[model samples]
Every structure is written in structure tokens, then in C-alpha cells.
Target: MSSRAFTAALACALLGLIASVAAAYVHYQLAVAPGYESFCDVNATLSCTQAYQSVYGRLLGVPVSVLGTGYFAGVLGLLLLGRRLDALASYLLVVALVGLAFVIYLAWATIFVLGTLCLLCLATYAAVVGLFFIAGAAASVPMIDLPSRLSRDLRRLSGSPAALVLCVLVIGATATSAAWFPADSTAAVQTPAERASQTAAQVDAEPPLTDDQKAQIRASFDQLPRLIVPADAPGASVVVVKFNDYMCPPCRQTFDLYKPIKAKWAQQAPGKVQFLTRDFPLEGECNASTPTGSHQASCEAAAAVRMARGAGKSDALEDWLFARQTSLTASIVKEGLQEVAGLSDFDARYPQVLALVKSDAALGASLGVSSTPTFFINGARIAGGMAPRIFDYLIEYELSKTAAPVPVQ
Candidate 1:
């Protein structure tokens, strides 16, 4: 039974490692590659992408999956060295217990706090739990004195130079891997100087658009069907409409990415560029197309913003909510609605407000918007976030065209 269980635990660890890798890769694709869809993003409520996009996906700036990957790999390594080690069962039990702690916390966060589920995460959790039970059941040492046995064996092993070197190597490897893992949502943000340097590197690599290229892009952009128009642009020659979700990571990134572009519009074109936003939260609570909901507060947050429109606090409302994306909850959103809009009639207005979000979502669906941060630049559709250069180029092109009228195709 002991041999069979150890074998099972090894298999579980391998499976867990694969799941961790999948989770890490999913988040990676979402960050650098726009419009990338995951097979596991079932909806807002049951999305792997949502959990990865949330703060819970990373711990202390390192991707949680990286830790998980290391953990499962360590388990396999320990088990492989089992025959050479004394009191292997005790070590396995102790290690399993340590990993179990993370599983419990992450499971709770996924269900209660983030209000989303990741299929790959669930698989990893199962593997961790299985390892705990298998190790405990197959323990050769006195199970009741696991800690004492583990401590004694660890001390014995530490006395050997070979074991000591191996321990140091493993520790160093885990730390170094975590420190160097590439992630967009690290705990420490980039300083302005760092950002500038990165921007300079990208600029040097990406050649500027020539006049002929710009003209071709313009001609093609004009021929694309215009499916959306701004609701509030009075004399604006160009309208930029975005279908955004407050809970989505890319949406927040895109919002920040557009700040400089928005600044350019204000400074150079003034009323020539008009920007608008529409709701397309991935949550099924408001979006019918989503079979399962993620982002529990998304619909409520949308309602709050809709209500804020009456008070002309919509922009402020967006800013406030987006800033708290990491910790947003339905109760928090509702409470904040009262605090910001401070409307006594917020609850009464909620149903209608939510309906407006639904309406916007329906429109987004008709326009083939499959993800958050979808854009419509004067009717030409873009399904995901764009590069900074392209965003600026399109806007500038439209501004240049404002001097003369061209009929819509």
C-alpha cells in the first residue's frame, strides 16, 4: 500500500505541475497577446482568466502558479530521492501539509473573494489535497509524532555535506525562479524612468508609419462597417467607443494605456475626438451570453456607474471603481455607490440601471465583441487592446480627416 500510494502521489504531482504551467501560460498570453481566448474562460463566474487577472493570481509579485509549479516539482524530486533518504514519509507529510495551506487559502479566495473559478486551479487543488492524504496514510514513521520525526531526520540529513549542498541548491533554485518569473502584475510597479526606457526600446524597434502606409490604413479603416456611434458627441468628428469590464485586467491596462492618447485628443483636437464607454462585463448576472458569471460585483458596479451618470459623476465613478479592482465585491460596490453618487434612490434605481448594462451587452454581442476592452473607432471594430502606436495613429488619422467630409461606406 505504501509503494502504491507513493507512486500515486508522484503522478498527482506531475499532473499538478502541468496544471500550474497551463494557468501561468494563460495569464501570460492575456497580457502580451491581445484577443487571446482561453478554452477555460467559460464565463465571468467560471473563468480561469478572471482569477489569473485578479490580485489573487499573484502573491508578493510572483505568479501563484509559479509557486505551485515549484511545489509540485519539489514533491516529485523528494519522492524520487525517497529511497536514499531516512524517514521519507515524515518529510512527505510535512511538505504536503505546507502545500495544503496554500490550496485552502486560494480555494477560499477563488470562491468568496474573487467570485470566479479556474478549472486548472481546481485540478491543482485536488492534487495538493490528494498528496496530503496519500502521504499521511502511507507514513512509515509514527504519524502522531510526524513533526518530531521530520525534525530529527532533517537534522540527521543536514549533518551530511552532500545533503546540505542539495538543500541549499533547492532553496536557491525556488527563490531565483520566483524572483525572475516574467509577469505583468508584479507587486512593485514600474518607475516612470523604467517605463520610459522600455518605451524607448519599443520605439527603436517599431518603425514609424509612412505616409503611404497611413493612407492605406486610413482607406481600409473607412471601409470597415461602423456598428457603434457615441451617444454624447455633439460636433465630434471622431468617436471612440469601448466595451469594457471594470473587473477585467486587460480592460484596466487598456484604460491606463489610453491616458496619453486621451491627453493628446484633449490637447490637439479638443472636441474633434469623442470618447465613450459601454458595459460588457463578463459576468453572467448581467450579460446573458455568459453561461456562468465571474466578477460578482461587475453588474452592481455597472449599475452604480449608470446611476452616477445622472449626477455627471460617471467618469469619477469609473476612476474610483477601477482603482479598487483588486478588492472589489458586490457589497463594496453598492456601498461605494452611496458614498460617491450618494443617491438615496440608488437601490430603487438599481434594476433599471442594470438593465442599461444588459442593453449595452446585447449590443456588444451583436457586434461580435467576444472579450472585454473591445473597441469601435468610428465603426471599425477592434476585438482587443491595440499597441500604443496604433491607438495614436488611428486617432491622429481621424483628426486629420476632420477637415474634410468623407461619406461612410
Candidate 2:
């Protein structure tokens, strides 16, 4: 290969190095920091935290960015060797190809399985591709000579004690960094007394019962747990409270099932049908009901909606966040806040609403909620999720019990 190819590969390696370092920062912010928000989380489909928290983010319990940093450093060292390393072109080509393959695999996993995209990961992939194609195009060695050239390169490197030492140093540095790398994605189980409360947990619910199902639910209504909740509209015939985590798939399903029914009540019954929601993120950052980091982006989602309510943008923002629930991250929640609610100060403003979210989860815990999509239909607690028609049924049932309207003086 030409000398220019080595120089180009060196540039690509340097770019990759920068990307790896950035990735390390992202990993640390997500893994350790509580409620840390990055600028890269665009949605449920484009969250850096979600991508890093996934299986592909590490290799055999070691952070992948640490490994990547080592790879780029070794590449830089090899290229710096210049003419001292025999068959340098062949070595560059082989190394670049291997790196490219791994990059492609990560890309596939991130997009296909994880269903998300991270800007940092993309940057690394770009650098690796640049290195691979640049080295391949600039290779002067024929493909037939690759095996013998590789053999000669290895022998030459083995003969040079300094080159061998370089390899060992690169490896040792990588191992040392990996050993010291932070990976505390776990959230606190015992929330601070100030952070937690004895307040009832936002209770969570399921779909329309057939005749038999209706009969069964009604028969058991007398035996079901009574969930006391603050009514949104005093004297309202029916009140429905949903404790939801935006990133929970079942929660999203519950939202989808209830959307139209709630909309219909908003138009028809207005004040009579009161539909309320509470934030109950399964994530550890601001929620106590479940483990920390359980839902990576849920705290942000909760904060966004709560903030949106003040701006009269809750409906739009909530819909947008729920649509992207599975791929949410703090960054993604910030994006939704800006795009859906025109709240550009998401990072700054979200903290103000976090307390409310934590309080809601604390309340849900006291009320015996342990999962997302819990519901309280006028003091009746139902864990898990149910259908939309059930809300209508419950509303009708409550309506039958409501006192007749009192005449205004």
C-alpha cells in the first residue's frame, strides 16, 4: 500500500479514537449519573443511553468503548511504525477489515434488535468504514500475496522488540482502563426519606369483559382492594387514574387502548368523567416502585409531560412520548419536549418536575403498585393492564352511583 493510505488510516483511527472517548463519556453519564441527560437522545428510536445499556454496548462484561479505544490506539501505533514494519500495507488492510466487520455487526444489532440509533456509535462506525475502504483502495499488494505478506509482517514485528513492547503496552493500557471503567447502571433500592413517601402508589388495570368477565369482575368488585386517590374533579361521577411508565410496552399498550375512550369522554361528559394520570416510571432515577435504570428514559418522559401540563401542551407531548416509549432516553425525552411542546429548556426544566414523578411512584408503591399501567377507578385498584371498553363500563357503573346534580343558588 502507498504511504498515503497509512496516513489516511491514521487519520481515521484518530477520528475513531475521539469517538471512542465520547462514547466513554456517554457510557459514564448513563451508567452512573442519576438523571443525567445527554444531547444525543432523540427519541425511543434514537437514544444513546438505550443503545449503551443494551447487550452490544459491552463485550464479556467489559465496556465496548474501552476496547475500541485500545483498537484505535494500536492502529495508530502500527501506522506510526512506517517503513520499519514489513508489509505494512497488508497489516493495515487486515486490521481495517476486521474492525469494519465488527462495526457492521454492531450497526446491525443496534438498529435491528435494539431498534435504536446512537450518534456516537454512528460516528465510530463511520471512522471504521473510512479506515477500511481507504486502506483497501490504497493497497498496492495483490490479493494473492496477502497470506505471505501477513506472515512476513508478523515475523518482522516479532523480530522488533520495540514493536512487540508497543503491542503489550496498548493491551495493558486498555485492560487497566477497562478495569477502572464505571458501569453502575443500577439504581438505589432504598430512596432517601425525603425522596420517598407513604403516599399511595398510583395503582395500575385490563380490557372489556365479556358477559362472563363483566359478571366476574362485578361479583369480585366487593372483594377487590379499595384504592383511595385524590379525585381530580370533586363530585365527578367517574374518576380514572392511570399509573404509567412511558417506556413500558404494556403501558404503551394500555395508553393505546384508552386513547379514544378518553378522548370521547373529554368531548361528551367533560367535567363528569375525570381522567387522571400519574408518573410511575420503572426506572430507578426518580422512581422507587421498581429497580433503578429499569426504564432508561421514563423519568425524563414523566418530567416532560408534567412540564407540558403547565404549558397546556400535555396532550401533544404525552402522545408523542408514548409513541416512542420503547426507545426513550433522557435525550429523547428532551427532544420530544422541544418538538411537541416547544419547551427548549428541557434539561433545565425537567428537574423541577422530577419531584412530582418521584412522589407519584412513591404513592404508587404505598398503594401496592409494583408494575406499570396500574389503575384506580374510583378507589378500586387493578394491577396490570386492561382494555378500553372497561373504562367505559367503569364510568357507567360510577355514574349510576353519583348523587343527582345539586341546583346552583
Candidate 3:
């Protein structure tokens, strides 16, 4: 084959590889940014948000795409300047084989696990295959020790780089097919019921909480004077202590469910139940539970809540925090605190109050509160912010224990 044709084929492959890198960078940006809409918005079954946030998205500590982008960019650069380097063909040949393996792994994950493929990600997969073909074809041109059976056949195919071009076309076709035609919607869609069933199946796989841990959680709730309840007249057999983050959206929703329960029990059956709110922000600046920062503005929110509690405006502050959660900036939260409860001087005492909030956060972490809206009801954990229905179920379950005493025959 003419050198010009070979060069053109290599350039086409390189173009695809570059496009892949660009797509990967876009994926990274989407993952880190909060306001970005979910890919599922296009179609509920096709949401990239769920796939990107899953454990499968990361490899060790780094993002999978970050590593893929770097690797593909390196391979493309090496192939582009292959003529200058000595023993270029041998090195390129080995790297192509390694690239082939990575492409296979990515394809498997995208197909079987991720369920929905980002169209651009599929383009990157095709680019890997094209790169391997071009590199292999280029390497075979200057053969050193050709095998008797395969060498002669490869010479014809490699001589014109036709085989490599054909391979690129095949990859492009495969990627196009995969992107345009998706699997059945039913096959891909995992409804709430299915997810609940899946969770039930995995429940037995988890290790049970230890006795000492249970006792510690129980002791923490026992210390609170008036634990949080849902209804005005709670049956009063059990006390629930909740550790929550004001800036957390889910935590706010959880409180919305809990507040009514508390009111119902407080009015109907007063001395029976109590509810207390503990500050547990999931931010690295304040909470040491997590090593990395999840929420940047959580520490300030915690402090504002604390100041509200101190000024005898706990209920008002709690309402304010939940209501104006989206605008929980340092200034806004402080201003709200002052406006709602006459707690002035937020700026003058910012440093000391911030430190105290951080200390409280650390203390919550030391007591095994890793996530927001964690709860302990009479020593039993009700983890994850379930909806009002779940709250009702728990209330009934607790009341049943009182009604159905063990028979002593």
C-alpha cells in the first residue's frame, strides 16, 4: 500500500480517538456539578446520573473516565509520532494489545452493568478498536520475524492497510448500531418495587450491627430529655433521637415526615414520647466522619441551627432551616437566624460559633453518625430517609409491641 493511504488511515483513527477524549471530559464535568440535569430526563430509563453516581463509576480512588482519557490520549500521541521513535513498531504493537483489553472491559461494563450507554462513550469504545487496528497494521509493515503460516497472509492484508481500514469501518458500524438501537425498555427499567426487592435480597448479605454499638446508640437517645416524635399523641413506649443535617435536602424531607408525628403524639399522649434533634452535618470542614467534602456550606448551617436552639427558638430555627435550605449561605443563614429569633452578632462571633459547630459535628461522627438523617428509635436504627408511609409503618410496629404482650402460659 502507498505511504499516503497508510497515513490517511492512521489520521482517521486518530480523529475518532480525540473525539473519545472530549466525550470523557464532558462526562466528568456532568458528574461533579450539582445543577446539571439527569440524563434520565431524556428518558427515565436512560439516566446517566444514576450510573455515574454508582460504585461502578470509580476505580479505586480515581474516576474511571479520568484514567481512560489519559490512557487513550497517550496511545493517540504515541501512534501519531511513531515514525520518529526507534523500535516504534514493537512498542506500538504491545500497547495496542493492552488497549484492546481495556476496550473489552469497558464494553462489558457498559453492556451488562451500566444498562444504558452514553452515546459518546460508545464512540470512544469504537475509537479504541480503530486505534488498535491502525497501530497493528503500521507495526506489521516492517515485520522482523514473520511466522510461516500467518506472515504471508498478513503481508497481503497489511501491505495496503485495507484490513485496518475495514476493521475501523466494522467498529464504527457496531458503535452506531449500539447507540441507535437500545434494549427493550422493560428489560432496562428498574422500578421502585424491583429496587425494593433487590434491597431485600441483599439485606442478608449485610453484617448485623454489634451489641456494643446498639447499646451506645440506645444510651445516646436515653440522654435526651424530649426525643423527637411524629404524632401529637405518640404511644410513648419508645423514644427516637435523630441526627440530621439542615442543608441536606433528604434530611429536610425526613423532618417534614417526623414533625407531624411528633405533634400528634405530643398533644394526644404527652409524657409517653420525646424527640431530640442532634446536629450531624456531612461536611469534611465540620464532620470528620467522611474524609472528603460532600457539602461545602453544611458547617455554617449547623452553626445557625445551634444558635437558634441556644436562643430558645429551636422550633422556629428548625422551620427556617428546612424552609430556606436552598439558600443556606453563611450570610443568608445568619440573617435568617437574626430575623427569626433576635440572635444578632453572627459576624462578630462567626469564628467561635463555627468552631463550636465543627466540634459538635465531630462529636456526632465519633458516635457513629456517618450520614444525614440517621435515626435511633428505642435503640433500633431506621436508616435511610424513607417516606411518610414508612414512618406510619414504624409507628404502628412500635405500638403493636405494647398491645401484644408475650403470653406467659
Candidate 4:
């Protein structure tokens, strides 16, 4: 390609890299700084937050945007240095084509699977398309001594092993740093006093529930199906009910936060906490309240959990499912049931299991649950993800009402 066209390609790739970095920043902000409002979160259907937090947002625990940032950076480097390495430039064109294909798949997922359009994601997609075209143009430039040019470039690169190693190490370090340190470090440096103040502020910000409101919440909890409580749970002084979907990312986060608190309570005040999980699948296949095709595998997953519960393997199955939340599907659910619990009769029991799921979903819908991971503590609603301190406060508050001091854990 001409020098002018090659420079233009490099410029486009640079622009793309900038967009990827911006998306990564937004992702970090959303995760670490709760209630962050993004410019691209125009609505439910066009929310950048939803897209970034969804299952497709990450690949094998690393955020896709972080990977994109490194990818575009590498492409930018290759475009700038391609003049002296024709073979490398040609190979990058192939990489660009592969990247374009992957972006296409992500676009399909965003539209059909996620049912949302993240403007930042779309911007990155545009960059990839532009890079593919630019790379294609560069590759199309005919070379009289293509083979000889590649051979010479390879020999030159091989001869400078130290330089080559340094470059590889630099790229590897950058990618690793991006992945490991994606969140804002400042967010993690809060002092104990600052954290306590924040927790107190959050609790104070919420208006106290009136007696009537508390009674209504208690009645609502009493009406819902009571799933198995922890074997060692204390008496029902603090009944915690959760409406959760297996496919929901926030639900997974909430569960992770709750697990430790539940464990502590089980050790300290067994039988004092009555925790019940109710199915609230987001997919319309079993949950008539939800939009069709959204969270398509959720109903099946919920049924799988019910099957596990029947087989006395609910805890193991729940842990397994939550760990693999991003990849939950009918096949995976079946495999988990078979492998984790040895439920060979899943197919035979599926209909009964589905009935249990429907019952819970119906109960959730009756309680006005329009979203997953909704929580109720001692008949008072504690919606969305919360800090562990908040849960501790609520549990203590309930215990305080009874004239008996909570046993120290």
C-alpha cells in the first residue's frame, strides 16, 4: 500500500484503540463505583452497563474490553512498524480479519442474545471493521519479491532475539496488568472508618419502614414457598427471602456477598436466620412475566436446581451453577446434575422439576418481583446488591427487637 494509505490505516487503528480504552474505563467505573451513570445507558435496551455486566462482557474471567484494548494497541504498533516488515504486516491483516469475525459474533450476541446495544461496544466494532478494511488494502498491494521479503524480515527478527524477547515481554506485561488491575485502585483503599461511615450513610439514607409496611412484608414472606433453610439455622427471628435468577450476574454477586454472612450466622446463631431462595427465572419460557428469549436457559437451570434439591444435593449444585454462571445452558445444567449429584433420571423428573420452578416463579411474580436478586430481611425489602455490613446491621436490628443479645460469632 502507499505510504498515505498505510498511515490512514494506522490512524484508524489508533482511533479504535482509544475507543476500547474508553469502554474499559466505563466498565471499571460501573463495577467499582456503584450508581455510575454512563452516557451510553440511554435506556434498558441501549444500556452500556447491562452489556458490560452481562455474561458476554468477559471471556474466561478477563473483561473483553481489556482484551480489546491490548488487541488494538498491538494492531496500532504493527501498522506503524509494518513498513520495515512486510511479512508481519501481511500476517496482521489475517489477524484483523479474525478480529472482525469475532466482533461480528459479539454484535450478534448483543443484538439477539443480550437484546441490548452498548454504544461503546458498537464504537469498538466500528473500529474493528475500519481496521479490517485498512489491513485488507495494505495486503492487496502487490509485491514482486514477496517470498524473499518475508524471508529477509524473518531472518532479521530471528537475529535480534533480545529485541524480540523484550517486545513480547512488554506486550505480555501490558495485557496481564490490564486484566489484573482493571478496577480503580483508589476504590479499594477505603479506611475502616470511611467504610463504616459509608455503611452508616447508606443505612440512614433509606427511610425506616413503618409498622404497617413491616407487617405487609412479613405477610408476603409468610405466603411464599419456604425452600430448605440451612440445616443449622436458628429460629426465624430474621427470615431472609431472595428472589433470584441463576443466569443473572447481579444475582451471582449478591449470592457471593451473602455466602460469608450466612456461614458466620450458621456458626454463631444457627436457627436465628431463616433464608429461603425462590426461583425467578428471567426467561419467558417458564416465567410468563418476562420477555421471551431473554435469559433463555434460566428456566432450565432453575429446574435443574430443583432436581438437585430433590436428590439432596442442592448445596453442591448451587455452588457449581454459580461458579459457571456465565456459561449456564440446558446442556451444562444437565451435565452438572449428572456429574455433581448423579441424577441420571433428570429427563424423567424434568416435568416435576419444572412444576416446582413455575410455582416459585409465580410466587415471585405475585410479590411484584420484576427483577432478579431482590431480597427481604425480617419482612423488610432490601433490594439489589448490598454491602455485607448492611446485611449484618439488618440481622442485628432484628435480633435487637427481641430482648436477647445476639451471640457473638
Candidate 3 on 28-117: residue-level lDDT in tens?
544443323333323212334333444545555455555555555455544454444444455556666776787687666654554445
| Top candidate by lDDT | 1
Q: Sorted on TM-score, highest at the top, how do the candidates line up?
A: 1, 4, 2, 3
Each prediction's TM-score versus the true structure: 0.60, 0.49, 0.45, 0.53
Tell me which residue pairs clash in candidate 1.
44-293, 44-294, 45-293, 45-294, 226-379
Regarding TM-score, does 2 or 4 come out ahead? 4
List, residue by residue over 190-249, the lDDT tens digit for candidate 4.
333543454455446667565665555445544655343222235567788888887765
Local distance difference test, each candidate: 0.75, 0.73, 0.55, 0.70
Q: Which stretches of candidate 3 lie over 4 Å from their true place?
A: 1-236, 350-359, 399-409
Score candidate 1 by TM-score against the native.
0.60
| Candidate 1, 261-350: lDDT as tens digits | 787778876788888999998788889886455667888888888888889888767766765664578777776677777766776888
Number of the predicted model whose TM-score against the real structure is largest: 1
Misplaced by over 4 Å in model 2 are 1-212, 404-409
Better of 1 and 4 by TM-score: 1
Q: What's the candidate order when arranged by decreasing lDDT?
A: 1, 2, 4, 3
Q: Which ranges of candidate 4 are over 4 A from the true structure? A: 1-19, 22-112, 116-235, 403-409
